[model samples]
Target: MGVCTSQNVQEKIDNIEDDYLKLDFNRFSTYQKLENIANNIAKQQQVDTIFSSLIQRMIASGQGHILKILENIDNQKKLGFMTKLERLDFEFIDSLFHHCYKQNQIDAFQCNVIQSTNCQEQNFDLIKEHKVGIVFLCGGRSSRLSDKLLSDIGLPSKKCVIQIMMERLKKILMLSSENKEINDYPIAIVLSDQNQEKFQMYLKSQRDFGFQSINFILEKSLPVIDCKGQVVFEQETQAIMTPEGTGTIFLQINSFINKFPNMEYIHFLGLDNLVGLPLDPQMLNLISKQKADVLCKVIETNSILDDRIFYSNRQFKTMDEQDSNITENSYNSTQMLLNDLYLSVSFLNNLKYNHEKALKLNQRYHYIKRGSNIQFEKHIQDIIEVTDITILHQTEDYALLIDDPRKAVIQLSNVHKRYLKLEGTQEEDLVEITPQMSYCGEDLRKFENVSYPLII
Candidate 1:
C-alpha cells in the first residue's frame, strides 16, 4: 500500500467516526431514556408561571402523558416506602417537580432579588456587569442556499447572509480591525456537517469576520437517519438531521475558549438571519454597550396563536420521526443536564467553568420529537439556572424599512417578513448597488455599514 498522507488519514478518521457516530435511533441506555422523560417534566414546571396561560394549554393538550407521570410521582412519597432506587427516582423527579411547580411559589414570598433580575431592561454597560454574552445559533443544513452559500436567496450579489452580517459588523463596530476589538467580545457561529465547503469559501473571501483563527468548529449532530441514510426533519420530509439545536453553539464556544484567553461576551446570531441587522455598527456598539448576555430578535407578528412552543421538562424517546426523535427537558439536581444550557447561557470567565464536567454532560442526549414535542431536560440552567432571568426590552431595538427590502424566511417554511437591515443603506441613497459597483469595492464607502445592531 502507498504511504497514507494527511488527506488520506483525515478521510479515514472521518469515515470511521461517521460509522460510529450514527448510533441506532432507539439505542439509548435504559437509564438514559428514563432520565430524558423525567427532565422534560421539570422544564415544563420551570416555565409554567411565566407562561401560565400558554403552558396550561400545553399541559392540557400536548402533555397528557407527561402530566400523568408527574401526578403519579406526586403521590409516591406519601405512601412511605423509600428504597434507594425508588428514592432516587422520586428525588430526581422531585427536583424537576420543584423546578417546574415550585419556582412559581417564589411569587408568594416575593423578594425584590428575583424581580430585579428577571426580564428586566438592562443597559449594555450594566449588562456587562452581569456578564451577558451571545451565542449565534448558526449551525444548520444550508439546503436552502443553492450549491454555493453566496448564491442562496438568488441575490445578484454573491454575498450570503453571514458574510453580509460580517461586513455590516466590521464597519459599525470596527470588529475586524487588527486590535480594535472590545475586550472579551466574542461572536460565535455553530456550524453543520453538511456545509463545510460553503463556509470555507466564506473564510477565504471575508476572513475579516474575526474569530478567524479558530472561528469554525463543528457541532455534533444528533442521530436520526432514514433507511437511505438521510436525516429526518419536520420542516421537510426527507431532510438530514444536523445538529439538533442552536443551543449547541454554546458548547462549541466553551470548547473554543480554552485558546482565546481574553474573550468575554458573546453575540449569538443565526447564520441565516437575513433580516439580521449585522451591518449596522451603531447596532453592534449598542448591543455591546447594553451588555446583553443573550440578545433575541423580536419581530412583531399579527398571529395570535402561540409562536413560542413552551417546553416540558421531560425526556422524549422519539416515537415520532420529525427532526430528531428524542427531546430532553428537566433533571434532578444530581442528574443535571449541566452543559445543555451552558452552551446558550452567557456569563463571564470571572468564574472558572468545569470543562470536564461539561464534556460528561455532552454524552447525554437532548430531544425534539415526532409531534413537535420538545424535551429540555439539560439546559443553560445546570450552569446559569438564572437565579433571575432578565428579558431586556428596548424600543431603540427597531429597524426601519431600508428600501422595504425583504426576503422569504429560509429556515422556516412559508414564513415571509421584512428582516433587520443587514445591508444598510442611508434613506437618501437607499439604492441597491449594481454588479459593477459592488465588485469594485469602491461602493463600500457609499454605504454606511456596522456590525452591532444598534442603529439610529
Candidate 2:
C-alpha cells in the first residue's frame, strides 16, 4: 500500500478519465463516489498540515473547491499575473479568500426614524459645539462617466466636483470661524493607488485647493481574479489591481480618529454624488438632539409605511445583490453621519470579525467585471448593523449620483437652480453658484436680476 497524497489523488482522477472507455459503466456506484470523496478529504488534511492559519484551515475543512483551484494553479505553473505561487502575497489575500469562501450573516437590529419636518433648520450653534470630520470616498475610477477622474467631472460653473466639494468645506470653515470655532476641520480623502498620483498632481496644480492641510488615506488595491480564481493581468508586465470596496474604508477609521482625538462625528460623502451636502446643518441638529449613533439619509417613495423600506431597529439592508428581500419604495442616498464616540476600536474590529464570518450560503459567489477582469467587493452599507439609526427622509433632489455625461449636464443644472433659488431664471439658464456666494441656498435672491447666463 502507498501513502495517499493530493498528487496521488490527482493522478488517480487522471487515470480514471484516461481509462473511461475500458471501465464497466454499470460497476460505478454511490459507494465508490463516497469513497473517492473521503479519500480527497483525507489528502486535503495531509496537505493543510504544512500551514497554520484560518485560511489554510478553511481549505482543509470545507469542500475541496479552494484546494482544487490552488492545485490547478500549481500544475499550470503560470498564473496570468505572476509566474509562480511563491510570488503571490498570500498574507495580503488572506482576508479576501476568507471572505470569498465564508457564509455571510448580517444580524438584524431595530431602527429609529427622524422626519425632515421635525429636524431643526440651520442649527449652527450645535455644530460649533462639537468637533467633526469629513471623509470623501473618491477611490472609484471614472468607469461609465469617462476616462477622466470622477472628481474632475465639470459642473455648470466650470468647477469640477472636487472643487465644489472643497468650496463647500471652505464655507463651513468660514462659518465655524465666525462662531469662534477656529479649529480646522479634519478632512480625509480615500484614494486608490491607481488614482492617487493623478489626484495629488491635480491638487498641486490648484495649490492644495487653498487648504492648509489635508489627510489622504490610500485604499488597498488587490489583484483582480477570474472565474477560475486565477489572477488577471492587464498587460504582459503588470497585474490589474482594483480598489477593494467602500467597506474597506472602515479599516482606516480608527487611525483617522486617533489623529483627531476630539472628532465627535464623521460625515461620509460619496464622490459620485455631485449634490451631497456634508455636515448638513439640519442633519446635524437632528442627530445632536436625538443622540443617534448612526444617521442614514433616505428617500421615501410613498406615503404608506407598509410600502416603504424603513430601517426599523437597524435591520434595514442596503440594496446590494446579497439582499434577497428589497422594498423598492425607499432607498439610501449613501451619505451618512456616524458618531465618532460610538465607533471604538473594539466595535470596528467586531464588525470586521463578523463580516469575515458571515458568508453567502450554498457555495454561491457574485463577481463583477471591470474592463478586462472580474473582481469581488463588499459594501460598507451592507454590513452597517449599528445599534441605532436615525433615518432622515429627504427629496430625490439630494440623491443625484452622476454616472453619465448626459445626466451630469441636465441633473447638475437643475440642482444648481434649486439651490441658488433664482426664481426668474429659465430652465435653460446657465447659472453658476459658487460656495463663496452662498453656502447653501441662503437668500440667493440677489442673483435673480443678474442675467440669463449669470456667473457668481
Candidate 3:
C-alpha cells in the first residue's frame, strides 16, 4: 500500500511471497538442482572456449530476439509464445526471459534520468550553422576485432576503422561548413577502459586524423564475475572491469557536454559501425529537418536470415570496436551463425524490453530507497510518466546488429578480409582531411545480399 524504504527492502527480503518464490515447475527438486548443475558443468566442457568468447556475440544477436520477446509481451503474446515453443532448448534463455521481467527494477534505480538528442543553439552561422554535433559510442574491448581501433586493418593506409568512421562523420557534419553551412562542429567520441590513455596519447602525439573536437572520454567500468560471484581477474582499486551498458550512455555522456552548451543536434551513433549509419554523416543539416523527439537511425532489414550477422555487427562495430579490438583477434571467427528472421524480431523486442526494464528498474529503486511512505508512492507515478520513444525509419541500405558479441568479432574479421583482398585500401578520404573527401559522395556502394527485411 505504501512505498518501500531501505528498511522496507530488508523486511521484504526477509519475507518474500511464498507463491512468488514457488516456481510452478515441479522439476526444481534438490536432486534436480544438483543434477542440473552437474550436467551444466559436464556440458561446460562441450561449450569450449568458443562459447565463452561468443557470450557478447550471442547477447548482441539475441538483443533482436529480445526485442521480439518484448513486443510479444507488450502485445499480450506471452501465452502464445509459450504455446509456440515446442522444440526449443534454451539454457540461459530462461534467465534472459526472467531478466527482462525485472527491467522495471533496474529502471527504478535510474530515476533522475532524461535523454536529449537535438541541439537548440541560437547562434546560427553560415559554416557550422548547419553542422551538428555527433558523438559516436565507440569504446569497448573487442577481443574479436583484435583491438582494431589502434591497430591497422592490414590495408593500404593501415588506418584503424574507428578513424574510418570518424572521417565519414566529419565530412558529413562539415559538408556545407566550408561555405558555412555549419560552424566547426566538434565530433565527440566515447572511449574504452584500457584504451582511454592510448586514445588521448594518439590525439596529442600521433593524432593522425583531422576530425575537429575529436574529444574522448573513458567508458564506465564495473567488475567481471564468474559463476561463484568471484572476480575473474583482480580489479584495479581505481578502475573496475565491468562497464556500463549501452543504455547507460544516456547519462554518462552528459558530463562531457558541460562546456559545449551551444550544441544544436547530436548524433548518438554506435562505435564500430563500419557498414554505414542513417542520415549520411555528410547530410547532418537535413537529418534533423523536422527535429523529432528521438530520431533513431534504423537500417532496412534486408531479409530473414541476417540476425546472427546483424548481432555480430552490433557487438563488434558498436560496442567491441569502441572497447577493445582484440574481441576478434585471430581465433573463433569462423563458427558464427546468422538467422535473419528471428533476429529481426529479437532486435525490436530487445529495445522495447530494454526501455521497459529501465522503467522497471526505476520502480525497484523506489522499493529499495530510504523514502517516506508517501514519497515512495509518488515515485511509482514517476515510472509511468516516462515517455515512450518514437522510431524514425532511415531510408537507407545496410543493417548491423550488436546483440551478439561473437558474430561481431567475426564480422570485423570479415571487414579485414575484404580489405586484404584490395591492393590500396586507404582510409576513407575524409579520414585523411582534404577538401575533396567532403565532396566525393559518389562512391557509396549498395548491395544485393541484404537479409533482414523489416520496418524499424
Candidate 4:
C-alpha cells in the first residue's frame, strides 16, 4: 500500500464537518455514549492533520524515504505503534544530522588531580549528610566482555560481573548504614530493553543483593538508518535499533530525580568496571565542597584508546573557522581526556534543557561504520564542550574497565588478591588455581572459598 497522497489527505480533511451539532445534555444523558461520539468526531478531524504534519516534518528533514518505508506497513497500525511523544523522538534524532559537534570547535585544558587520601573527616561528614543517588550505566551489551556475564575469573565463589557489582553495592550500603545521617539512598541501574529481563531475573536470583530498593531506568532505542538514509528493518514489523548513548543518562533519570526531589547529587559509572565503589564519599565531598555542577573523575591518558580529558579553555569558533576544519577526525588534536562524571540535579536539569532545545535546531548527524552497518552514537564526554566541568585527577587504577576476556580475567584475579590483602588475609591461606583450570562441568561445589593463586 502506498502512502496517503496530498489528495487523499485533503479528502479526509474535507470530510470533517465544522458545523457538527453539539450534544444536548437532555438528548444524551449517558456519559459513556457521549464520550464515544465526541472522541470519534475529534479523532476523525485530528488524524489527517496529525499524520500530514508528521509526513511533512519528515520530508523537511530529508527523511522522505522513511515515509515510503512506513507506508508499506499498515498506516493506522504504524501510527498506533508510536505515540505523539515517540514521533517527536524520531524527529529529534533526525535533527542530529544538522547540529553535530565539529572537532575544531572544542578546546582542551589539562585538569589538576586531587588525591582521595587528601579528603578530610569534615568532607566525609558533609557527604553523609547530603542526599545522593547512584546510577549504574549497564545498558551496553557485554559483547566485548566475553559475551557472558558469568565468565568466572577465580573468585571465592564463582561469580559473574553482575554478581560482583551486586556484592560491591551491598558493601557500600553496609558502610553507609554505619552513618546515622545517611538514610534511604537509592541506586538506579540504567539498562536497555534487551538486557532488562535477564538482569532483573539475575538480580532476583541474587536476592536483590541486600538492597532495600533498586530502581531501573530502561534506555530508549533509536532506529538505525542505512546508507540510503532509510530505516533498516530488523523483522517484518520492527526496525533495527540501537541504544542512545551514555549521555542519555540525563534524560532517562530525570523522572527518577523528580520522584526524589531532595536528590542533590548523582554518581554514575559504567558496569564493566569491577572495582568501582558505588557512592565514593570522596567524590561526593569534592562535588559538594567545590559547589560544582559537574565533577568529573579524570585520569591522565596513558593508553591510545583513552580519550583525553580537556577543559574548555578557548572561545567558541566562528562559523567560518568551524566550516574550514569540518573534515574527518579534525577533533583528534585535542589533548585532555575524560574519565567518568558525577552530576548534580541542577547539572542534569541544564543538560535536559540544552538537549530539548537542540532537538529543535537543524543538527548534523554523525554516523560510524561498524562493519557493514552504520551506527549513530553520542558520548557523555561531549558535554564538556558546552558545560563548565571541574576535573579531579585520580589514578588509572581507581577503576578497571574490562574490554578483553583474557586481560579482564588477569585483572579480576589481581583485584581479588588486593581485596584479600585489604581484608588482612594472609597469602598462605590462598589456594591458587592455574589459568588452565576450568569449571570442567564437575561437581565443584566444594571449591568455594578456595582462593586461586595468581596466574603470574
Candidate 5:
C-alpha cells in the first residue's frame, strides 16, 4: 500500500469536480460519501492531518453518526471552495448573523438623564479626574466631500480636518490639566488604508499638534464579494476591497486600551463636525455617573419634517404627526450618532466580542454595490441594540452635522462670515479670497456650557 502524502492527496482532490461529487454521493453509502468529501476538503485545503485525526477520534469514541449527516450534505456545493483569506471572510460574516439584533428594539434607560443645563462644576471635576480616550473615525474615503477632509475650511494655517481636531484636543487638555504640562490622553485615529499614509504625513508636518501620544489604527480591508459569492480581483494579483467602516475601530483599539490602563471611556466623533468637543467634560461626567454602557448625543428637531425619525422609550420610529405647527418635540435627524459613545475597557472588550459575533452571524454586514464591485460594510450604530444605550438630547439650533458638501460649504462660509463680523473687519478687505487660503471662524464657546459649540 502506498503512503498517502499531502501532495498526492491534493492532486486527487483537485481532479474531483463538483458534479462528480454530487453524482458519487447519490450512488454511494453514507459512510463512503462522508469519507470521500472529508478527504477532498482536507486534501485541497492542506488540512488532511487535522481532518483525519478528528475523524479517527470520532470513530474511536462511537460518534461516527455525525459523519453520516456530513455525507448527506456537500460542503463545496454549499460553502464553495475558498482560499484561506476567503475562509476567514466567510467566518466573519457567519459570526455577524448571530450578533445582529433589531436596532429599534434597544431599551433606553432614562434614569439620571444628564442635560447640558444640569451639568455643573462637580461634573467637570469628575471628568478631569476620570481617564477617558477619544477615537476619531477619520480614515474614510471622503468620496462625498470630494476626497478632501475639510481641506477647504481653514485660514492661513490651511489646517485640514485632522489639524483642527488636534487643536481642539490641545485646548481640552489645557483646560483640564492642573499642571502647566498637557496631560496626554490616549487617542486612537482609525484610518482606512487609502488615508493612512496621507494623514500620517499631514500630522507629522504639523508636529502632531502638541500631542504627547497618538495611536493610528489602520483598518484592514476585505476582498469584495461578487453576486456569485466569489472574491473579485481588481488585478491579476490584487483583490478589490474596502475598509470595514467605523465599527472596525472596536477591533483595532485593544492595544490602545492595554497601553492606557487608566482609560475608561471612549468617545467617537467624525472629522466633518469641526465644532464637536471630543473630550467634553459634561458628557464624560454623565457617562461615568450613569454607569451607562453606551451614550448617544442627539438634538430635538424644530418640526416633524426636520425629525423624520424619533426615539420613543428607546425605540426609533418615523414621526406620525406631520403637522407643520406641531409642538416642540425631539426627533432623529441623521443616523449619524454625533458625539456617539462606548465605554470602559471591560465594555469595549465585550463590544468587540459582540461585534465579531454580529459579523459572523451576518447581522451587521450591509452589502452594497460600488460601481462594478460589491462591498460589505457595517455602521457603528448597528451595535446599539446589543448594547445598553442612553440618548442625550439638545435643541436643533444648538446641533450641526454636515452631511452634504454644499451644506458644509455654507456652514463654513457662515463661520467665516461670523469671524469677520467679530473682528470688526469687512470680508472684502481683511479676508483674502485667494485660491490657496480659506478661513473658518475660531471656536469661542466654553466646552462645559454647550452640547454642540457654536463656532464664532
Candidate 6:
C-alpha cells in the first residue's frame, strides 16, 4: 500500500493479532504478543512498509520498557494500573520516541548584543498590508489559577481579561479602519484540554467578542512518565497527559496559516499580560525593517534566577539559578512576531527536540502535580537559539497572572490607574476602563462623572 490511514493499519493488525484490543498493551500477557503484531504487519504485502517499521520500532523499543515497569505485578493489578494510552495515536508516541533516539543538534552561534529600537504607526498601515494573525498562548491550565478558568479571572470593575482583550482588539481595528469597515483579524487561541470546553462556552456566551473569525487551536499534549521512565495513568482508559510546551505552536502553524489564504505573519502573545498588546503598525514595521524571521520582546531584568531569563547571545540559552550560564541579564517577555512563510513542521520539530534536550539536561523543569503524577513541560522560547530574532526591549509594565490571581488584581488596578492618569487611586476605588472606553487609557476623558468602580 502506498499510504494507509491509522484506522486501516489498525484493522490489519487486528485481523492478524487476536488479543491486542485497542493496543491496550495490558491485554497481552507476554512480550510475544507485541512481536507478533509487528511481525504480522510486516508480513502483509498490503500494509505500508513505513507503517510496519514504525510499529516494529515501537514494539522493539517499548515492549521491554513496558514489561520492566509492570514486571512483577499481577494481570488484574496491571489492568488496574490503567495505562490506557491513546489506542490509535501511536504515531504521536512513535514520533516522540523517534526524537528521543535521534539527537537533533543546534549549532551554537556567536554571542552578540541584540539591538533594540522603536517604531510607531498611528494608522496600522502595516497590518493592513500583510496577512496577519494573532495567537494567544492561553493553554494554561486553570487548576494552577485557583481552580478558575483563565477567562473568568475578574479584573477591576468585574471585567474579565478575555473581555478586555476583545475590547482592545476591537478598538485597534476601528482605529485602523478608514471606510468604516473594520477588518476582521484572524485570532488563534491555543487552549489546553483541561479548559478548552469551559473556555469555548465562555466565548460562546460572549458571542466570540463579536468577531467574524476566531480559531481555537488545542495545544498538543504529552504523556506523563515517572522518574523511572514508565508511563503513568489516571484511569483505566486515560493516561496522565499534560500540554506540550509552547513549541507545539509549530505543530499547528501550517494548519492555522492555511486557514487564511496567504497568511504571512502571526503575532504570538500571552493572554495573561493584563496591560495589553502593542499590536500597532510600529511593531509590524520593525519586523519588516529588521528582515527578521522572528521578533521577541524582552524586558531588562537583573535577576539571574528568574525563570524568564534568556542568556548567551549566540545560543539563546535559558538559565536557572543553578545553571552555570547565568552570566547575563534580560528575560523573555513571551511576546513574539513570526513570519509564517519561514516556518515548517520539519524545521520547528528539529528545533523543538534540540531545545527540549537542552532543557532536560539543564534540569529546567517545573514539576506540577496531577493526582498522583508529576510532569514537566518543554518551553518554546528555545527556538531563539536556532533562529535570528530581533529583540525589542521594553520596561515591565503589566500584571502577569501566571502566579497569584489576587496580586494580579491589585497590579491590574495600579496599571489601570496609571494609564488613566488617576493619581492616588487605590484598588478600593475599583476603577474600570472598558476596552470600548479606551484602547490604552487615551480616549477616556470624554466620560464625565464616572462613578467609583464603574466602567468608563
TM-score list, all predictions: 0.42, 0.63, 0.43, 0.60, 0.59, 0.63
What C-alpha lDDT, on a 0 to 100 scale, does residue 295 get in candidate 4? Answer: 60
Q: Which of 1 and 3 is the better model by TM-score? A: 3
Q: What is the lDDT of candidate 6?
A: 0.53
Residue 251 local lDDT, model 2: 59
lDDT of 2 by residue, 186-304 (tens): 77887777778877888788887666677888777666765444465443335566666556666577788788766666776664555566566766666666565555555433232
> How does candidate 4 fare on TM-score?
0.60
lDDT of 4 by residue, 338-441 (tens): 43567778876776577643452213233554455555655555554454544443434433444544454455445444533434445433332222222111
Residue 108 miss distance in model 2 (angstroms)? 8.5
Steric collisions counted per model: 70, 14, 94, 20, 17, 0
Report lDDT per candidate. Answer: 0.35, 0.51, 0.36, 0.51, 0.51, 0.53
Candidate 5 similarity to native, TM-score: 0.59
Q: Between 1 and 2, whose lDDT is larger? A: 2
Clashes of 4: 20
lDDT tens digits, residues 1-456, model 5? 887785675465445433233433234474565565556545554443345544433332233333333333355532232222232344443233223221223333223222332444324453365477788877654343214573655343355556666666666665566534464667778888767777788778877766777798877766565543445644233445677766656666788888877777777876655445667666676667767666666544334322112334224422232224433332323233443554556676776667554464234455555565556666564455554444343423222334443444345444544534433333322122222122112333222232211233
Reference-based lDDT, residue 30, model 6: 52
Order by lDDT, highest first: 6, 2, 4, 5, 3, 1
Tens-digit per-residue lDDT, 412-437, candidate 1 = 11111112223433332223333212
What does the lDDT come to for candidate 5? 0.51
After TM-score superposition, what is the CA distance of residue 175 in candidate 4 from its true location, in Å? 2.3
- Please give the lDDT score for candidate 2: 0.51
Cα lDDT for residue 118, model 1?
A: 18
**Count of backbone collisions within predicted model 2:** 14
lDDT agreement of model 4 with the native: 0.51
